[model samples]
Target: MKNACYCVTEHRAPLQRIIQDTPELTGDQVLLRVTASGVCHSDLHFWEGRYDIGDGQDMSLSDRGVTLPLTMGHEIAGEVVALGPDASGIDIGAPYLVYPWLGCGDCAVCDRDEENLCPNQARSLGIFTPGGYAEYVVVPRAKYCLPLGDLDPARAAPLACSGVTTYSALGKFRDAIRTDPVVIMGAGGLGHMALRMVRALSGKGAVFVDLDPAKRQAVLDAGALAAIDGAAPDAADQIRAATGGGARLVLDLVGAESTITLGLAAGLKGVRVVVVGMFGGQIKLPTVYFPMRAMTLEGSYVGNLKELRALLDLVRSGALDIAPVTRRPLHDANAALMDLRDGKVVGRVVLTPDPA
Candidate 1:
């Protein structure tokens, strides 16, 4: 079989189409007929070739070992087409969400089921290797494949990245989430999914913050406690008033200068702030604030394989509500990415090989 891929031949350039013959799989590998793939904001950074790292500095993907002609879709769902001789416990023709955060299996982190935290080699699909911006994908191992069951492939695709990322971050402070309403920044894809996740997993609710009135309204419609405009002069004041003093936990999904500043300002004493977005920018805070307010700041990357399975279980049980998803054909990936980068997408956009 020849696989047709939309590859990043050059940074900031449209993905060029390439067809290559699918070769025989090595032991433990499996061939997947790509069913659905999500267009994520991180793809924008990969396409642009660098992530802004505050001031005038940037981190280049090329310097980090990412090469051109890359197929960059990590949030993927596909049907198993074939398996290697040693690949076990997977059924052919069954749809599953592929866990893309891979590492060398011998690492300590990988041994602990925390491959996403692997400090050594990161063979993460779509980033470091071939991904699902095509009709087919090659998963290095069956362990990376989780059964989608009755979940819609298009809707389930984002679960591999956005869903699991938010879920893992929320799980970190589930106690605080259960006791008090958390402040959620940004009402885009991650924020929307987090709203549903908080509802399903915690007793308390979330007060969402976004600059866009439409996004604020969307979260409000999704049963958020309150949706505040981040651009409002009284935004931090509004958040403080809404949370009664201040929020105990803040999920900074925007992860930029403004959102970080707002989270810090709106936080109560001993507040835990988790930054999950890749919208890179730096912030400055007085050193005294850390000790005086006892605030905690943490950065969360995409989740691990165990978290992915747990999230999928919640999704399969109907406990978790699926976020609104915009479906586009696989061939329209470039346009879909441009739309996402331009803030034109209301919710997550999933690319399906067959858009019928």
Candidate 2:
């Protein structure tokens, strides 16, 4: 039993190919034959030595001690074939969503359903261990896999991460805050999908801000009420003005010092700003305005299984239209990552392990 895999050996170098024994499933693990995995921009962040987010096993450099040389693919989907009897309630041969986060289950965070925050936690099938880049992945806990019936597995993969992150960010403000108008910064992969989600979940105000003319138009085509140029000299004032004094909610999907600065610049007095991007930047705040405006700033990471389920329902019901996907062979993972990094592809690029 042999398996093929794409392994990232060094920073910026192309992933090398390797053959290994087919993974053995633990009694508590569910083994899935890899079908589709989305090449995410975040994966590039790791490859380029930009973002140091992982469980500290493979990284040459560690953030709080998480390392790299890891098999990359966080957002993944496939069919389950084997599981330990201890892994009850999950049937073999069922198509399921893989929740990548693997946590210390008995912790306070896990008990509260915030496993991403678990002190001893790490995401599997990507960040923690050999991920979906290979033909097979061993999932330690069956509880994390969500059922995907009749949905295109390729498109569903990105929903596991990009979709879940953006949707989770929007979910909080979907019901409570001002829905009259909502603003999304960055019209890239996640931003485009967010435009669709906002329209589906929160129907009041839909405004998109992006530096790319093509992306700006795409957001508008996806049903944004207004697509303002993010690079406009007075973009902040323009956004603030367009939203009728201010947008109550602004999702900064491209977080960086500049965009975070722009977010503050474009935000209303009482807006809720959620920063979800990993673009290596910081926000500078004015000490005086923090208390006076009653504005809120929150950071959201990839969502948990509960949020993934809600997002899947939206996708399953056809309320959210995922961007069309582009396919490539497993060996072409480098090109897929490069395309995503260079802004050459739309939607997501999904890699098929067995392209026959």
Candidate 3:
């Protein structure tokens, strides 16, 4: 079989169509026939080639070892079409979600199954390696393929990224989430998924912060106790009011300057703040505030395999309402990306493979 991949040949330019003969896989690999891939916000940064790091500075993906001609879709769901000689466990033709945040398997973090936090090397699909924006993908190992069971491929695809990312972040402050409504920043895909996971795991809800009136309304409709305009000057006050004095836990799904400041401001003393978004922008930290407030600030990358399993269990149980999804054809990848970049997408947008 030949692989037809949409390659990012240049920054901000449409992806170049590249066709290549599918090569024989190594002993540990599994070949997946791409079923659906979710367009993620981080793809914008990759497409643009750099991330804003505040005060006129930007970080280049190339500097970080990402090359051109890359296929960039990490949130993937597919069917196992082939497997390597040594690969085992996963059945061919069974649907599965690909876990993209990979690390060198021998690392201490990877040994603990928190490969997403691996600092030495990142072999994450669609970022450091070729990903799912194509007809097929060769997952490095069968272990990365989590079975979808009864879940729809379009919905399950996002669980690989948005679902697991938010789920891991919430697990960090599960105690606080169980006691009080955590304050969540942003109501986009991550925020929406976070809301559903919060209700599922903690039996509580959240107060959403977003500048978009429509997003705020959508989160409210999704069962957020309250929604505050992030652009409002009194946004922190509003969050504090909604959470009673101050929120015990704050999940900043938009990790830009404005949301970071607002999330921190809306927290009580001893509050734990988890920043999970890659929206990218530096923040000015108050040195004294850490001690004065006894704050805990943690950065959560996308989740690990074990967490993905737990999340899948939750999703498969049908207890939580999955985030609303908009389906688009695979060839419309650029248009779907543009919509996400323009903040026009209310929920997640998944691209289904073209008819065979």
lDDT of 1 by residue, 1-356 (tens): 98888889999988888998887999999999999999988888888899888787899998888898899999999999999989999999999899999988677899888999998888899999999999999999899999988789998898898889999899878677888898999987678789899988954899999998988998899799999999899999999998988988999998899998998889899989999986777888899988899998888889989999999889878899776688998889888988988879877888888554
Higher-TM-score candidate of 1 and 2: 1
For residue 283, model 1's alpha carbon misses the true position, in angstroms, by 2.1
Tell me which residue pairs clash in candidate 1: none
TM-score to native of every candidate shown: 0.95, 0.91, 0.94
lDDT of 2 by residue, 33-86 (tens): 777888987777667665523333233434633455678887778788778667
Candidate 1 matches the true fold with a TM-score of 0.95
Candidate 3 TM-score, C-alpha based: 0.94
For candidate 3, the 10 contiguous residues with the lowest summed lDDT are 315-324
Number of the predicted model whose lDDT against the real structure is largest: 1
What TM-score does candidate 2 reach?
Answer: 0.91
Kindly list the per-residue Cα lDDT of model 3 for residues 143-204, writing each as its tens digit: 89998887899978888888888889999996767888889988876787788788888646
Give me the displacement of residue 25 in model 2, in angstroms.
Answer: 2.6
Task: Report lDDT per candidate.
Answer: 0.89, 0.76, 0.87
